[model samples]
Target: MYPEPMSKSLEGKLVVAISSRALFDFEEENKVFEDSDDRAYMDLQLSRLDVPAKPGVAYPLVKKLLAFNTETDNRVAVVILSRNDPVSGLRVFRSAQEANLQLERGVFTRGRNPYPYLTSLGANLFLSAKEEDVRAALNAGFAAARVYPDSAVAADRHPDEIRIAFDGDAVLFSDEAERIYAARGLEAFQAHEIERAAIPLPPGPFKPLLEALKPLQAQPAGAPMRVRTALVTARSAPAHERAIRTLMAWNIQVDEAMFLGGLEKADFLREFEPDFFFDDQTGYCDTAARVGPTGHVVSGVKNEVGGPRPSDR
Candidate 1:
């Protein structure tokens, strides 16, 4: 067996914090009635706890964090939970402990306060706090939006990390949908989506990025690898052809990919876990951030464009 690494201070890498709900992908049985008190908090973070998750499902998230941590020596999966919710908090911490997850001390909620726990620990917490936090971060030129209310405070914890994730298609790829929308309009875009459902769409804008990281992939972890990447797109099976092709063309490999069809992406994201998940749509990012961290990829389409070509992004 490989010797377990000692838990040392996470000094230089990015931390992708996740909640138990996302870490375990709680089963349907864990579902709580929407009427519960925990389901109606002002910050919206507490309300997400009603969703149930199992610790066993946290393997991937743990493994990725371990790999990232081992390679770059800067990765940590700080499991953040509210001390007010002791049962869930204990469950999350124990699960990580059993897996020997390289966790930066567990967080026990600071209420409306932003204590910057991850910052003090030298790892970033990829989340935001309150709407003001989002607005202020964005206003201050930090990539901010109403990511996930529950984990919004995540940003408050770690502000230095790039903390980015991606959804396939329009986000990382060109605005083909917007292109189709311009050429044939909304009906055409929808038609293209349906037609391309099996044909697979082309790569998104970030394809070049993945290609750039290819060399890094060859460099083993702990040797100073920057950026943690994943694919949290809603496409699956036959529809996933284009995403795979794009990566192949660009020669970029992602750290992870979850094909969830139309199921709540947040459910799977809770497990793969990310600092921020970028998607063209708001709902996916909204739900995903609840479990981990999420972001919206702004479209940079030119208005007079004659539609997106394969080489566009």
Candidate 2:
């Protein structure tokens, strides 16, 4: 017998579920809530309902991404999966309206874990400010990242290009090498890469998301905006060969690749000026955030988290 068809409403679309804090600057109100309580926060947001919040780190990325939906048959869907109570979510919608963002759906968890809903949403990627939520999302098999509020906001570097960067080990690939590095030291890590250069490292949390992006990357040549991915890793020289070979093994292509070894990535990211950058280490995110939007992958040995969990991919 033949199988059932897919849901037309969501068939062949890239769905991204992001949080309010990740999409808009809720730092001030977040401070209020943290210093005080939820009641005070809700009151503040309701009082300032007419006031629009400023764009946060992922704002530009979202705006550019939504631009791809101009076609009658939409190719993308973005949902606001925020932890804010439904009441406070008003401000989020108001801000999205102020920015002329065409967002239409959301789920306000009211301080509860929002990761479970990602499965029902069929989310290809989830972005949030809460590390717990991101971790939960990843554990549940969805691609998730913790947005750094302190990181640089998205810039109008190139209106027609969607530039995204990714870190190597512990991010695009499994933390196996990271495990060796942490157990021993940098010397051991380099040695492992050299020895296993021909062996492709296991896939990491973002591999599913990267695979999903391939078809989107193949969009028409002159589409208003196109995705240009880059591999910005800390591995340099002999270590770089393995990474290149690994991508070749996976049959994936990155527009540009940078192997910075041990150098600080902020300056390099500043030059690349990606709309968004994902790294497993907060250090890179903190520094790179100053240049452009950034997200922290809360996975692998460095994250003090467990190995890849079985999930949706």
Candidate 3:
């Protein structure tokens, strides 16, 4: 066996923080809480304590990510940070064990929000089923998303290849152009993009996570499937130049870039069939979730606490 590395500070490791619901199917239990009460929900969860929870939308993506840790030097950590009380947490641990997920750390905050502990975990990404918690995580300066439970499970094509897709603005780049579009519409946003074609948008929360993947991408060719990435943005034609140029300026090369303007991403994503997809808008997130593993990046101006819903626009 290879000697494992031990790092107290998580140095040289990619840490992911996720909620129990995002990693496992909790719709039935959540419905119990909504239809009756928390006490009743706890009772149900307790009764089924030994039963392993079914995998949720993020399961395939997490499984592929954990595969990269097959070597001792390559480190990837996933922690369960959930609002589930300690009593209900017994099932969560049992489920992870049944799934063979090497999760050893978690924070059970009961009814309290758990976003505050994300920093302590040195998390590069946070995924949960709760929109409020995701927004809180983003506001706290972490790459976070709200996973949709109804998303289809990922296809295991190219078992060795791990492909991930990301939205350009808001999710990867700052919400700069998104703010303009929200205020003055698409025409203005396009003109602004043309004007700043040479200027690279500032990095968004996920930039760190993307940068972290660089080392993994550099692995030897003989290694089992490597990581492949794509940028699927809603910007087309003139506006697309800025996003392309920005990535060039950053010296990062994505395997593919789809510039779909005002088109429903669900069908397009259905064809691409990525392990996961992340977007800031709820409409896209909700739609894509039905096709495959998806995460709702909740950052940018549109998600402001008091702002109107993006679907209203």
Candidate 4:
């Protein structure tokens, strides 16, 4: 009898599922797709098969994450989970090869929602340009965000380091306090947080992704790549105490924390130069996108139909 084949697994690895549009600059082809149909888009991609797509907003972040992997140590896995057809997938794989991205797996749904595959892939994070897909992933209890395609490219200041920034409520922690703030006001929210300062806030959708990064962050000093995380939140003073204490309770350590209160976060993001920043409020995301790559976490009360605006927060 033949020997049993070795089983393949992504155990203990950080798995990221990224859409093609979020991974490459497919805006022109996407326009063709939107204006025409799948056939036209496939035809255009086929003709440009030899051409490599430019890096998108999330390229820098993906590149740095992949750097965690080594010949002997496979620390990360990035799979292309996109809506493009199999034909267009050729171009994506070709472009990744040209860009030196060691991506080897993908799933093409040809315009269908691909969030369901996240479960089988054991994905810790999912980034896509489609809000619907992002919502589905988050609803399914996975970390997901809608990428801002037009956002500025990441800065080259920290080429070897991956810097990620996240908002407090909704993005990292449950939006319980945010709902209180929305229904009552900032004063009520602050009071609630103060009352629960000793208690750790519940985990949000992105908490798992943050936890996955903890091991990567603990790598030895000689590792080729490093990760730096920051919390840039609108909460100030007493409210900040809960946020800090929450991380402490979870045993997660962030490199920096900025309690900006209600001040604009764009300027602060520009100075921090994170590879990507995530927030639940579109208004804050819109402004932050101008500085660097940003993702909109479509969770929490702030994202509801009649939710309060960023200015109100």
In TM-score terms, which candidate is top? 4
Candidate 1, residues 1-313, lDDT tens digits: the string is 9999987654443444444444543333133423454433322433444433344222343444455455434434454532224444655555556656655456656233223443454333323323443333323322323333244323222222233467776655665655665556545655666666544355554454445334435554544334557787656565466666666665577777776766777777666545556665656656665666555543334312363333121
Weakest lDDT window of 10 consecutive positions for candidate 2:
304-313
Model 2 root-mean-square deviation: 5.1
- Write candidate 4's Cα lDDT for 1-313 as tens digits: 9999998998799999999999999999999999999999999999999999999989999999998988998999999999999999999999999999999999999999999999999999999999999999999999999999999995466987999999989989999999898888888999999999999999998889899999999988877789999999999998999999999999999999999989999999988899999999888999999999999999988777675654446
lDDT, candidate 2, equals 0.86
Each model's lDDT comes to: 0.48, 0.86, 0.85, 0.93
What is the per-residue lDDT of model 3 for residues 1-313, given as tens digits with 9 covering 90 to 100? 9888865776678888899899899999999988998788889999999999999877877777788887456578888999988889899999999999878888999879999999888898899999999888888989988988888885476588778899988889998898888888888989999999999999887888888778778778987758889898889989999898888888888888899887888888888888889988888888888888898888888777797455422
lDDT of residue 264 for candidate 1: 78
- Listed per model in order, the count of residue pairs whose N, CA or C atoms clash below 3 Å is 23, 1, 0, 0
Order of models, best TM-score first: 4, 3, 2, 1
TM-score of 2: 0.92
Measured with C-alpha atoms, the lDDT of residue 272 in candidate 2 is: 84
* Candidate 3 wrongly placed segments (more than 4 Å): 1-7, 308-313
lDDT of 3 at 170: 88
> What TM-score would each prediction reach against the true structure?
0.42, 0.92, 0.92, 0.97
Q: Candidate 3: RMSD over Cα atoms? A: 3.4
Position 92, candidate 1: lDDT = 55
Which segments of candidate 4 are over 4 A away from where they belong? Answer: 1-4, 305-312
